[model samples]
Target: MENISFNMVFTLSGLKESKVNRYIYFVFVLIVYLLIILFNVTVIVTIILERALHEPMYIFLCNLCFNGLYGTAGFYPKFLSDLVYGIHLISYNGCLLQIFVIYSYGVCEYSTLMIMAYDRFVAICKPLEYHMKMASKTIGRLILFSWSFAFLTVFGGIVLTSRLRLCGSHIDKSYCDNWSVVKLSCLPTTVNNVYGFFVILSAVVQGLFVVYSYMRLINACRKSKENKKKFMQTCVPHLLSLINFTLAILFDTMFSRYESRDFPQSLRNFLQLEFLIIPPLLNPIMYGLKLAKIRKVVFRHHRQIEDSLHTKKR
Candidate 1:
């Protein structure tokens, strides 16, 4: 076989079985995609419009919602298009771009959660220093660091991937991923593997940081009833979101690195798509329902809209 061409296209084998159920699957994906956009956008807009929610915690929540939208944008539209057209092919450059967006999204989720953990720690564990520690300028720098670090980490993986000479053009999953792409290379991927391990280790450390933050929070809350209530109201939602995201990412990682072709197609697909589906949908719902300030503003705006509609009808 000749070296992989610049214009080469990869056939995504994950969708081959969905041909008969294409429209049904398409409609289902379309509905979920719409919900992702609706819920995430609602949170983002609410955070932006409500000045009371302009604190570091809510700002981070807004970034998380926006990241959900950014990440899903890389997958759903392409998957929807493939479902409608009965073609599951992606260009070489397109696949790399998708890998960058999706993986960066994953990393950004962790980084954002880590910053949020810090924010919560300051708020609950050291209330007196919260404002000084998480001031507006400090929050801006933290946000910048979170997103920039994620982009550069994944960009390094993509750069390593782009240099490989591919031996095949088939990816067995519904979407492009760094591991799946690296597996296609004809030559040994030592550099890619090393860099990939570094990235994974970085994410694991971020997750550990969040866990440690919460552990201290739990212990601190044990000492004071008011602190316990604050932990329940604010930190619990972050913990839930962290757990949800961690599980989804774990499933995807396990499946990608140790995937078995013998597994049922449906099960395999679910494992691959879980992170993309569950976290984006769950994060906003969890935050909207659990965070008192967001819930109050969401409902207030909702009631105002309903009242306006009722008056119009009258």
Candidate 2:
């Protein structure tokens, strides 16, 4: 028995959604949000300031952090307000915007990683042409393409969604998603389904491209110790980031498609919140700590700041 929603406001019922001791949730979310901002901005600023880190790999890593920031921006603010007020209601337009920003961020993650892998592949397998292949102009084009591709792809879905007349306004997740919204539509979503399949096809294609690139990289790495070291230093982080994001999105995909009330609310909450929480918080940290040049520059800055604080204390 589906509840018929008369108007545009959608109710989100994911997570504990507790009014009791909600200040605890507020504080927790606030701390995590602040940490995300702090760590991501640290990596981004480090890349900007360090001349030694001006390579295409670092540039794409910076873009990954930017995507993380973009994605979290859609979630943390609204979520904090919800925690504070204990309200889970969102306007139809706000929900759409959330879906766009958050899903675009997800898509951007895949695209950013794809480009990053390409950068690594060229650098490792064709060192002589790396400069020619990944020049500043080329880099700019790729970044633009990554972001533009994501925005346009997600926007296409949003456009299709806006025309639908919803039969139910209740979403069983903490945030709005395109599928959740589409499920509410009383009209047949045949076109939407086709477009959705297209989106999946596109993603699958990207995944295959990444896998092929990595296979080539692995073959090149086996040829020399230096290549292996470089791969371990740079490529490993990207792989981990990819695996992290893949799992998070996988959880979300499963949750969206197979939602059931019999499952515990906590599990459902995790499915909804995993992508929003872990990747945004960890991606920068992973890149920051694992990549040698970034780690060096970061630690140098930390030491310098610590010394300056000690001098002030004196």
Candidate 3:
């Protein structure tokens, strides 16, 4: 692994070492990645094709699925290719690009959820102004803001990481991340630390706002049966997804940043992969199962396909 900024390379030291185990890991991950792509793309296409599903909530759900695909793309392809190699290495630019895509996907998840929370809050608590406030134009602008914030913040961190003169190349993880790369640097990382804290603080603030919005949503639901049904149908899935994504990433981050050698490597590897595996596959499943509109469209299409097959047999 070279260290001259332009030619620098990183060694990913976390892959399965045995030849047989590596093949097993590769097939398993390939299955998971295909399912992730299938489920997310299904939801995205469902939303796009069904005009009735073109509401703000569904649009936000589409964006979430898009982010899932975006985030997973960062690690899965390269990791799968590396599985066949005895030594897993990534170029410095490749590392930075992976960091930017993966982290930005996380930030975008938080941003999309926050926007959905606000949409629910307005719909339930401020019913009269829901349409006016969450107009088509507003939703577009909000999504634009969500993605822009993600790109800019992660880019800043990437820039900070790029300036560091790395003294090491080995990263004891399955993929590249800003923190892991930063740890390779010999010099102090004060600026990177402050910026990292800022990013976390911003995410924390977003989480708090989401909590407050849900609280208000709960209160509003108490007075109306309709609101309660909506809450159960839509808001519950949103909360679960938020919890699912947040906890997976948080657990990964917790162990990644401050984990111990006392833990088993197998367990560490599985936990490290939770965020990438669970949310992408589950978010689309959750929304497809929980959201009535999407479910109806899915079921109806299934029946139609079955009927078409039946006719062909006849």
Worst 10 residues of 2 by lDDT: 1-10
Q: Which stretches of candidate 3 lie over 4 Å from their true place?
A: 1-3
lDDT of 1 by residue, 6-82 (tens): 67999897566556698889999999999999999999999999999999999999999999999999999999999
Question: Worst 10-residue stretch by lDDT in candidate 3?
Answer: 1-10
Q: Higher-lDDT candidate among 1 and 2?
A: 1
TM-score of the candidate numbered 2? 0.95
Stretches of model 2 off by over 4 angstroms after superposition: 1-7
Estimate, for each residue in 228-266, the C-alpha lDDT of model 3 and write its tens digit: 998999999999989988998887888778977888898
Better of 1 and 3 by TM-score: 1
The TM-score values for the models, in the order shown, are 0.97, 0.95, 0.96
Cα lDDT for residue 243, candidate 3: 95
Q: Which should have the higher TM-score, number 1 or number 2? A: 1
